[model samples]
Target: MPKAYSYLRFSTPEQAEGDSYRRQMAAALDWCKRKGVELDDKLRFHDLGKSGYTGANFTEGALGRFVDAVQAGEIERGSYLLIESWDRFSRQNAMTSTARLFDLATAGITVVTVDDGQEYSQERLTGPDVSPMLLLVVKLSQAHLESARKSNNVGKAWADKRERARAGEHKLTKRAPEWLSLEDGRFIERADRVEIVRRVFRETIDGYGRRTIVHRLNEEGIPNFRAGENRKRKPTGWHASSVAKILTNRAVIGDFFPGTGSTRFRTYQKEAEPIRGYYPAILDEDTYWRAQAVIASRRRVTDDDGRVVQRGAAGRRGSGVSHLLTGLGRCSICHGPMHIINKGPLPRGGLYFECDTARRRAGCDNMNRWRVDEIERRLLKHLTYIDADAILRGEASHGEFEKVESVKARLADAEKRRKNRAAMLEAVEDMDPDSLARYRELVADVTALKAELAGAEKALAQTAADPGLKARLAEAVDLNRAMGEAEGEERTAIRVRLAEQLRQLVEMVDFHPELSIIAHLKPRADVPADQVPFTYDSGNWRLELSSDSEPHGIDPDIFPEEDPDAVRAANAFFLKRRLAKAGGAS
Candidate 1:
């Protein structure tokens, strides 16, 4: 006796819940039993939820594998290929789909269509009769045409929905971020989940990497929010990739992307232009971008193969090591990395930061050994908050403030012009060609200005939300407090987080041969690299203006005019006497 193989397929997964799956399986089994052929139950081929019109079944699905086996001599030559109909195999192009059916028949395998009870064997197909081949072509052509009409209808329906969504008459999708819920056709932030999202962003802004944040979340046993509430299995713990996606997702800032590709029968789609203010914002744009800046600061520049080609000072922030400053420390003489060297034990021997160049005898000779614990302690205490008061007093928001005011002025002017134009038009009994043209021109101008103003205001909000400077300082303060309270491994973790935060503030720590450590602080926390070097000398216990030959006081322009007293105090913190650098007063 010959063997029979059943190949079943359906376009959408929803069809499995309908009569498609059961009907096709029953037809295949019934036909095989009646013909007295052994059904190959071990090698069942079913392309569930796969599209036939796109030829996905014949390309990547199980149907393709079945055909390949038949052609490769894995299946017997007299074997039967059972399907519900010709459409169940493929609704692709007429010529291509017909070729697939005949290809199996020519390979000595009989193709059986159970619905119409038609069999296309090598003998019958290559016989003198033209009706069988003509019928196959006609059936496949009709299927292709039917699929094309249905595809067009669906595309148009989605286009209408998108247009309506843009007009605020409809919502584009029911799917939303895990932190938000789709209620009454609108997305609302879930308070509990929203807090978790906020914490992730805060941790990132505080110099905690994605892995660190994921570890903390998992250790705390926070219920990891995921999609598909009806899923059988849920994530037991947080993942680094999931945490990274949450940090980078624009949906947190109320952005909705409608995607560029056709999503009707597809699972994944490419993101197109974003629809702003689509959801109730869980995070301000500033907090979102600040977190992005922090992430970018720690990200090492990698090559095509993900090999680290260049690394910033903060690139080694979350290496799970006890070294406080690995990438940030540089030898003053050779400008090489200061690597930590362990001697013997705890009390008798401690970890020391040795210049890698001198230790390895590579290029330059500058031997300066600084105790790791002492360097970490003094740097955390003195350097972390060196320019905290100045930053928190609102100096960074100046540039963005001016931008908002400028946009507001232009917006007001546009509004006034629009009102004047409307009044003039209403006063006229009959509008002339010139008057109509002028009215249209003013309307466009006012609309463009309004849009500009909205963007300017959003940028201003992000500026006011400067999580970079103020957040870093607040994080350092908390870390300092936590270090005093924490012990053992927890203290070490806190030290790593503090070092990451310091990397955002302090650009470099140079250890000279004379036992004088120079701490070079950056102009701003948000910037990863800067040419302007603000130095704090351990020998003098004071902050210097720059590396220039002449030293000057703090710039007056940075201070807001409303609070002169606060400005004077901030100036005093910088110019006044302070603790020495990591090595202490020389």
Candidate 2:
């Protein structure tokens, strides 16, 4: 009696949940009973939740492992391998699996499929009988063509749905649960969880840091969703990353892009593309932007050792240092980072900045550095001068601040338009296909409009609150002048003001006795000189020009005294001579 191993597979979730597997198993067992084949109970393999539509080159879960075992001669010769049909065992594009099956037939295994009523004998398998091969080839070709057609249909449907969404005529396939609902149709927010979400966003945007927010939330008895209800095996508490994700999610801002078909259908298993959202926003656009800007500024902050100061970590200690210069500084010589360095004790250390490239790379002659205090002083002077002049010229009037209000109004308008489009799309979800297509076209138009609106709003907001631009034309010019002149606590206030405006420009500062000081400036298009004030002297040679001396030609034999290499050699020779004299004296 030949031993038989039954293999079964289903392509989709619907098929798995249906009678597909049972039907395949019953047919295979009936064939085994008629053929007088004794099947091994242990070797019966069934792959549920696995797709046969995947090409032959890809492995089919447990089926792949079983095949590997058979190829390794784990099963005795003349064993029967029974499956429901070629399609159930493999798909059309899987040429490799078909070839492997042929090889199994040659190895004295009887390959049989109950659905097709076909049997592969050793003589037919070894002799290359073209009929079975042709049958498989044709079936596979059909499968491949069918698969392509299905894919095209799905893509078209999704495209049409996206269009309808844009036109205010389509409804989302999966509605938000009772806890959630469409706000104007673009954002996903829970009425019950709105306060929690808002708090999370607020903490993150206000620079409280994600981890701190998580801790605060936990401390307030606001447990993890599962834990709050006192459920057994409660989920872990909220994390910083989760808070950060919420802060950045466009879903909160009332946008929905249709996920790509490959993800929607399990065909390619690739990442989905995010389409323009056609839904109501939970958070206002300005609020979303505020969070983003804060996040960006936080990312740019670094500690005295030049390492990034991550969120939830203790912020860098300083009298006044902004978080907007974290990773932007570069060495003038080697184009490496110019990090912050403190020369004294903790908290009160005199801070200086220098380029890491000059310290590491050989032959990098540039030595850039600057004292933090001195740099800040100069920056303040320049800012104060600019501010005072603007005030005197009446440039720092109420008119400038009115732009902020104008931008706020524009933001509100764009948001209103977005919501209206979302509502329109939701109203026509059950329309006819032709009407749906037209609706989708309209949705696409709205999508484009919303995108433009978003861009305009963002630009306007940036311009309104631009510290750099606003500083050069401040409405509080007199106050700025007074603050600039103020000392101690007053100076600290001015420092904060200047810090907010100039934080993005100054990245870091490093100081060394040999290299002096270096300052790393931001790569703004307007600011040309990124390297800060510093002096360089490499023991024997200094990069200083003699203002009073004239250049003269010297003979190579009569070397210049200040030549670094020559000086080193002379010192070495003198040291050796002194050693000889000491030996004689001894």
TM-score of each: 0.64, 0.54
lDDT for model 2 comes to: 0.53
The TM-score of predicted model 1 comes to: 0.64
Assess each prediction's global lDDT (C-alpha) against the native.
Answer: 0.68, 0.53
lDDT of 2 by residue, 1-586 (tens): 5588887776566776779877877887788788788778887677765656664323747667666777797888888778776666666465755676777777777778788778776776556578876776777667666766887898789878876876678765565422256566544656667778777765554345566577678777775544556567666888766776677666666565554534434543311223344545567765676555545655545599976543222344344333223343455455556566667763556665566666565556456555555544433322311233322342323333323333444344445545554565578766556545544655565566566556654554445444343233232334445655777744544443344334433444333434333433333322112111122222111111122211111123433333535533433343355456547868
